[model samples]
Target chain A: MPFSISLTVNGVSRNVELDDPRVTLLDLLRERLDLPGTKKGCDRGQCGACTVLVDGRRVNSCLALALSHDGAEITTIEGVAQGDELHPVQAAFIAHDAFQCGFCTPGQIMSAIGLINEGQAGDDPERIREAMSGNLCRCAAYVGIVDAVIEAQKRLADAGRREAA
Target chain B: MKTFDYVRPATIAEAVAASAAPGAAYLASGTNLLDLMKVGAARPDRLIDITHIAGLDHIDWLADGGVRIGALVRNADLAHDPAFVRAYPAVAEALLSGASAQLRNAATGGGNLLQRTRCAYFGDPASACNKREPGSGCDALGGENRLHAVLGWSPSCIAVHPSDFCVPLVALDAVAEIEGRAGRREIPLESLYCLPGDAPQRETVLEPGDLIVALRLADPTAFARHARYLKLRERTSYAFAVVSAAAALAMEEGRIRQARLALGGVAAKPWRARAAEDILAGARPGETIFRRAAEAALADARPSGDNAYKIELARRIIVRALTLAAAGTPQRLPALPASPFSSAPGARHAA
Candidate 1:
């Protein structure tokens, strides 16, 4: 049965008609919404390349059924940057050379943002590395990824303190 | 993935009724179900989404110092719950050691309890697997049997339950609550999983249309306080355990009063080492006694050719876990190794 559902994607309302219920959130984001920034690496949840923020929690969109998350507030990589300014995590990824092929950069950035939001990514490099293990880098840029996450966490914290002050 | 009719029920009774329909399955987080569906292992004609059902998403503290975790409680929230962490650190540790952060955020309590094995042969439709297709011969019997079971396996199937949470739950003596058409009933968590006897297809004791309501832990005691979960995997993190142990001990004046031990990656289900527990009951907390207990635990272990190393590994991990539990030291995460992708010719180094 085809059902019409509405979702809040990247702070905007997205209403779509689903002919098939098995269409995954990753497919919907890429095909229906035309947001191809969230790459689908393995389609299974193991790769973490389809990671997106659903209700402020990081989840692999490839495993998520589109109909199951009808009203969820989803934030993909395409929404992370402003009109001109990139998110601190994205900026840090560039500064730290966190990618080789750039296919997994969006997912790595989203996962890093989730880590910072969960307050798990402290200044410690080991903690950051463990927390970011979900996002794999096939090009072995893990060193730069870890450094970027740690730096981004510090920068986010500093910004938070400034806003509070 | 095949196109299936999806229905989200707002009530438990409706969900149960929907589950009773022919070729119907209840979907929660879809961490495992979606993957299995994609691989054609599970082809349900109808999916009943139960994530919207209310009142099944809480972690309640019982009056008797026990904890009642709802069926819909996500693995990540359950692991990070302060009450669960403070009381049963081993449970939290076991959950953390199992899957990645993204998976833990989506996997629910009931889903984890009912998650299937990760046998490569079983996932492949063309391969001969009794679990995937009953009455078929087990291809893993002689083929690439490194990850096969070392204990509690029948000739039909040697696949082990790939869950880290079940190890600690069995050690803690937890109970599973189920709701069926008749009424609600409870059973020991260990009884929920069945041994892979002649009928390897029957994984759990859950009856048709029965929905797992919650998991309840009894009163927290000394065993809960002195507990440790040690998992050894192929890699430092984000990998399934090669062999793991969840050990808890209650001591009195340097003597063992009560002990609980469960082994993972060794059997069809979480293998509870009751014989080893008996050996450590009255013994002193020392290396010799721990070694004896570990030996007693593996006395009945029957390993395949390629996985014979698991016996020695399990023995060492059991002893190490018991020693750490006796000393009240929490297990530390192992350091990460350099990525295997780093050695590839096209891999780029960090600037």
Candidate 2:
């Protein structure tokens, strides 16, 4: 039996017709939605390579079934940039060389954005590293990733302060 | 993942009724269940999607200063709840210590309690795991069983419960409010899990279709002042504990009025050290006494496999956890959360 689910993907509301219930959110995005930016690393929750914001909270899309997340607002890597202007976290990743092969970059950037939104790490480098531990980089880009997150968090905070003032 | 029919239940009654059928399982965040499904460990024909069920996502404060946490409350939300963190700091710390930030954000309170063991043999469908298949004959007994349980394990299974949250909850005497086909009932969280005896397949005391609606925690303000969760993991973060302990002390006039201690990653359930707690009550807090309590806590612990070192590690952790708890919980959680290095004076700065 096909299940119908409504989702807002990258600010665009989508009413998807699922042919099978076995389709995970990751598969739904990559296979059906024509969005391939979200990499499937482990295809399990262990590796956060398939991370995306479901209803503004970072979750492993691989483990989430599409039908279960009906009406969820999803933010994938493709939506991170505004036109050609890269998101702060994405630009920071480039500046800090946070990727070697660039496989884990999308997930790392999404997770960083989520962490900044979470507001738990503050400007603490160790906290940022700990918070970002979910996304693994086989290329050993952790040093660069941690630095990038710390710098991006500061920039976001500064931008917010300026907007408020 | 196998194809299954997903039913979104609007209420608790509907959820129970839908889950009453064989091969039906309630779906929460799917952090654990979905992973298991991918590995062919859990194959449910029908999924009762209970996430949409109303009135099950609250964190209510009772009049008696206790708390009633709905089953649907996400792990991150509960851990970061300011009032909850203040009252049950150890529980918050334990919650923060387990899994990654993403898993915590999606995982629910009830799902945490019901998470299956992380034993490699049980996760591998080809392996002979009595827990996965009754009477399959335990292969973990001789095959890379270093991480097997050190206590409360039977010949049928040596797997340990992998929940970090349950360690402190069991220690603090949390109660589970369950809704079954018959009616609602509450039980001590400590008794919720059964030791993997002859029937390793039957993990929890929950019958089929029994839904854990909420978990009630009585007032723990006395222990709040000196409560801490200390975890010794393979890494600084995002790893399960090799050995963990939750210690809370209620002190009176420089003497311990009461103590609660529990160990994790050592048994089929969160191993509450009632003997250690008994030993600490009315006694002055000191290194010698703490060591005695640690010894008492591991009195019956014998390694199920080659991981005899875990017994010693569990003992040391008990003492260190008690010491940290006696010293007092930090004004705020450490940057590294429950890691042993977090307790070091300049660890965060050095990092």
- lDDT string for model 1 (A3-29, tens) is 888999999998999988988999999
Docking class of 1: medium
Q: What C-alpha lDDT, on a 0 to 100 scale, does residue A65 get in candidate 1?
A: 92
Per-prediction TM-score, please?
Answer: 0.95, 0.98
- Clashing residue pairs in candidate 1 (N, C-alpha, C atoms within 3 angstroms): none
Candidate 2: where are CA atoms >4 Å away?
Answer: B344-351
True contacts recovered per prediction? 0.75, 0.78
Per-residue alpha-carbon lDDT of candidate 2 for residues B1-351, written as tens digits (9 for 90 to 100): 677888999999999999877799999989999999999999999999999988899999999999999999999999999999999999999999999999999999999999999999999999999999998899999889888899999989999999999999999999999999889999899999999889999999998999999999999789999998988888788988898999999999999999999999999999999999999999999889999999999999998889999999998888888888888888898888888776553222221
Count of backbone collisions in candidate 1? 0
